[model samples]
Target: MKKWCDNAALLTLHGNTVGMVSKEFVVSAPGKIILHGEHAVVYGKLAVAAALSLRTTLHIKTIHDKDDVLLHLPDIGVEVGWSVPEIAAAVALPVCDPEKPAPPSEELLQKLKTFASIPHDSADTKTLALVSFLYLYCAIVGSQKTLTPLEIRIESKLPVSAGLGSSAAYSVCLAASLLLHKNLISASGKWSEKDLQLINAWAFQAEKVIHGKPSGIDNSVSTYGHAVSFTKGSEPVILSQVPSIRILLVNTKVPRSTKTLVESVKKKYDKSTVVMSAVMDTMEAVAKECLILFEKMYKGKADEYYKQLEELIYINQQQLDIIGVSHIALEKVIQITKANGLCSKLTGAGGGGCAFALIRPDVPKETLDCVIQQLSLEGFDCWETGIGAEGVTLHV
Candidate 1:
């Protein structure tokens, strides 16, 4: 609910007078973490996710003389440019309608992949990032007569492919910036509910391009900000009044496939239907209880609430292990954090992407420092950040 877009300037480009609007600005959106419920969410169970303080920012600068759009992702050392006319000529962009977002068809995706010169079998970060950018840019801009040529440079504090919703954050920023650039949304203070919903819809389309299939939770949190209680086939219940909480976000740096993890959990479930059903039910209960505690904590801070939250964290982590998604590296993180009087659980798809440890408000600095030092010595990356951060916003 803060205002950052107040400076507006007019410029003359190519002997033509341009509109009096800010042509250069920055837009940012926060990454997300699953505080409770990971694989269980796949089973139509409840899950809780929050927007992380770590965010992805996109700087958009319009170029009047240029005929191409440039995308530079310095964090990943990727730089790609596509000619505006060529993109228009090659891909058949559908009509622009934020209210009714359509997923990219296989034909459209294949055309883009070929146009971008990406290998057909390649689904790497760079490839997906490029495709997502092109898909959103073309879809949002549509067949407008004047296609704005711009340079977009990205910088992110969140780690890529770590199950921290980095891609979703990136997509949200793109949607917000493109909407602003086209003047489809207001450039004033906080965006209205209608505008935010539009942005979320477009961002979800981009997420489908980046990820084969995704729950709407990541983009919803990135667009709406704060915390959300989500279940499959239902709209995310936003927790607007939830207070921010400090935690240690640890990255195991061990790559794992989310599809594989989900399938593994399914195999376990199929092997023991009754037991796995109970495990999933318990996970859902953990999420439901955590949601209630979050609301109560927002009303008034209580030590008892924190204690109960930590207990839920422990229970959820144990459930994840029982479901066979936990790896040795994740267990090591849990062990390290528990030894230091903190409860930790693997976020996202588990099997060694990232884990978060609850850091109580009363925790001693020395204890926190020791935990960090030990985790660092073991080659794991850790950061002390808060959850329930603001969502996407335009910068001056």
Candidate 2:
């Protein structure tokens, strides 16, 4: 890949004097929801996802006189530090190259687990978070012999392991901030396409540490922001023309295992390949039809457009139920929203995690508030936010 940096003067000022200059800044990236195509995406079907208004923000400060890197994640009640020299000594060879990105090697990962005191069999959020930070820090900033000691604090509005792309958002923020600190990317205005790609690549590597084998949709949406149409083994098609739509993001709060849910679907597919294949085809059609409707809705924001969109959502939800991913809580959410004259569907790998309800433009504020009140009474957390919001951004 081509290296895209700001001018040489800016590089000389920031890149050459790493420890001499103290830097402080913030970067943020949005969480994501799979608007359509949940289990079927595993079968190489097309899927749609959008950036959420809920974001993960990172506050970074360079500690010029210190020799340790500190990470504070208040959301998970984690505060830890590692000696820079110790990390440098532990990894004698470079593991990360932003210009030529690759997956984290097993040897490097094992070293990180040992250095951080994480167990080899552990996959908890705190453990994964620490490993991701150490890996990114070593790979991105460790190359500089005069690496600056730093402190990074993360705060996220998105719930962890709720089928929202919270981890991806966090990773995107880390990549952007680290790249900015190294003067590998611009710190002003909007980041270029090349810069965003580099950030996305690094973030995807971090996602691998977290999710094991991510579909790349979460990091792509978090890094690029806005909405994207994705298919397995293909580049994401950014839907730039898709207009922002308000929705009720209802969290069931009942935890579900994505791995288990995916495996369950696979078993069903194996039992009856012909039946499951047809279902997958139908799900793909739903996604394609939704994509076309989204493009058309951009040109003319008519009631009919929304009507068709709601119908698609309804049909897609039925398909998800057919494949046996829907839960009682999710069905309850759908019924409650439907009673209020809105369309709803389960997002993500949903045995039960989150379901979003469409809030039409003509829907009265009082009606929306009532729906939220009713859902809150039923023990579900709901947020009124727009989809397709801006992606990873630097705060000035």
Candidate 3:
């Protein structure tokens, strides 16, 4: 990945001429963790999600003499390019407004599948990623009057396919950079709400390409950072002013299929629709309670707030267990954390991926360190990170 300049600038040469534009800028988006109501969100119930300290970063540099578009994803072992003229010829342009981009056609996607040699049903992350990148690049940039030769490099701090919203962050970063690269969004000033909406809409297109039926929470949180009260078919209520939170995210390193796990939940719902509906409603209520306590906790009462938050966290985990999402590894981690006075819950589509623990502010540093040490000794990866970070901000 290209080294990022924190305070990046627009690079301009002596004079302005046709096909002689070079700009260097950085775009970023945060990965998200669903705090409550993950599976229930699909059933039109409320869910609470927040941006993680972990984020995906995209650095875009324009090159005038470059003959092709250079794409680099060092994290995914993908470094590919296509000559500019050839790509422009092969990619059919569709009418796309930067503010309201359209998804690429099935015909074009099929061609790309063959070009990348990925089967339609294959779960290869890199292949799926390239398909998304190519579609967004072609639809958003190729639709413009003039396309620039640029290099895009992406890197991330979050784990892929472990329910950390890696794909959503990648897509949001791409949409932001492409819009800025096309000069549809300027690098000179602060981005407006309308600009953010456009970025989120474009990112949503990418979500469809990847998840097929995402509930839009990932894209929204990745695009507009911080916490949100999310539900289906309604605008997410953003909690931008929420206080930053500290937690320990531990990875069990056990890969589980999100598709199979989600399908299991659906099957349960199909068998007992009335009972499942009530559980979803209960989950939604819990999420709302968490949101309320979160605000009050931020305002004051550190000790009292932590106790209530911990209770809610435990309750939600039990609910997930009832829905049959918990695995033995996850239960073990929760048990280990609980033994040390901390509370935890599975964070994502949990057959077995990752879970986190709430580190109360009042907890002694020695105790916190001991818990992290114990988790490590048990062969799990742990990181001390914060939540409620800003989303998709330009460097300068």
Candidate 4:
């Protein structure tokens, strides 16, 4: 992954051309991991997250007309055109005119209303991803902001709704692109660590428009461009490098919806405090243990650290299984990986998306290849990728 840039500029047109087409900023966001906390994180439990190599990239080019805001996602072959008049008409609410400014706190609500009025489905994963970004861009610029016709095209290797945080990656990439286009970053130079944090926070806010209450782990890791320990209320804390920990991401492609899974979990939790409290308490302990393992590894106690981390991952996976997020394919992948001498578990929101395996440093490349082929034969989409990727960054 490349570093962020600030010297982005517009491509000059011929003398006769009136509009300046900016150099397209290709922004990319990475997939994520739920190292410790999964369901418990929703209730504000701590969780460790890492950026994955699988990423979503968005390409943005400014166009000329107010009615020509076009969005295209080539990977899924989705394209949409938005007219300015249509946006204005859709946003004119009964309580306030489209032409007038609303109060500060209500600003976000009004923008949300505009988002709801736009013809997009919360159920359509890719469309929700697109509209969330567009809504943020339009609202951040406000009514006085002039948008030259713009065309945005997204292409990704990340699978949709597959627990890889694909949609969050799309949202973060889109947010970074629009921010770069609007000159929201510091003018002095490349994006600083603080700038990346700001980007992640803003991206998390954008995702709330879609997910209703996202954990913020996905966007935070994606924006920071590296592995982090994310807690919803606190800032993401970066982790130091640990070479022995290698991650494998496997897709079950079961096509589960996160909302449905979350609702199911919520219902179960609401019905039984003893059961739910015990489960969440277990997850919280695992997160704390994982953190201790990381600290030990960083402080040169490698042997004990690996053992504790592996235990944490194994126990966490089982908890997710008991909570009803693990699918048969996920279990199969975990079994195969473990049989091949790797520590493996489920990643992301569970239900039926992706599983993760922590490979031993001594494991040969052939073993990894064999595991991938074995999974593929069983009709699983297997991918081996590294952790510790850079978060969201813009390419000029």
Give Cα-based local distance difference scores for all models.
Answer: 0.85, 0.85, 0.81, 0.68
Predicted model with the maximum lDDT: 1
Candidate 4 lDDT over residue span 255-316, tens digit each: 77667887888888889868987888898889877777666675685655666677888898
Error of 1 at 122 (Å): 2.9
Residue 215 displacement in candidate 1 (angstroms)? 1.5
Off by over 4 Å in 4: 1-22, 64-67, 83-122, 141-144, 187-189, 230-244, 257-279, 296-307
- The superposed Cα distance between candidate 4 and the true structure at residue 324, in angstroms, equals 4.2
Worst 10 residues of 3 by lDDT: 11-20
Question: Which digits, one per residue and each the tens of the lDDT, describe model 1 over residues 277-338?
Answer: 99999999999999888888888865658889999999999999999999899999999999
Please, what is the TM-score per model? 0.92, 0.92, 0.90, 0.78
lDDT of 3 by residue, 1-396 (tens): 333334434422212455333367667889998899888888988899999999898888766666777888888777887666766666665446656777767878777676556697766666787878777887778776445677888999988777888999999999888887776664542678888888898899888777677778889999899988878899898888666889899888888887798899999999999998888888888898988887886788645777888888999898899999998988988998899899999988898889999988877888888988888887888888888889887765
Stretches of candidate 3 exceeding 4 Å from the true structure = 1-22, 115-123, 270-278, 301-303
> Candidate 2 — what's its lDDT?
0.85
Candidate 3 has what TM-score?
0.90
Clashes of each: 0, 1, 0, 4
Model 1, 340: alpha-carbon shift in Å?
A: 1.4
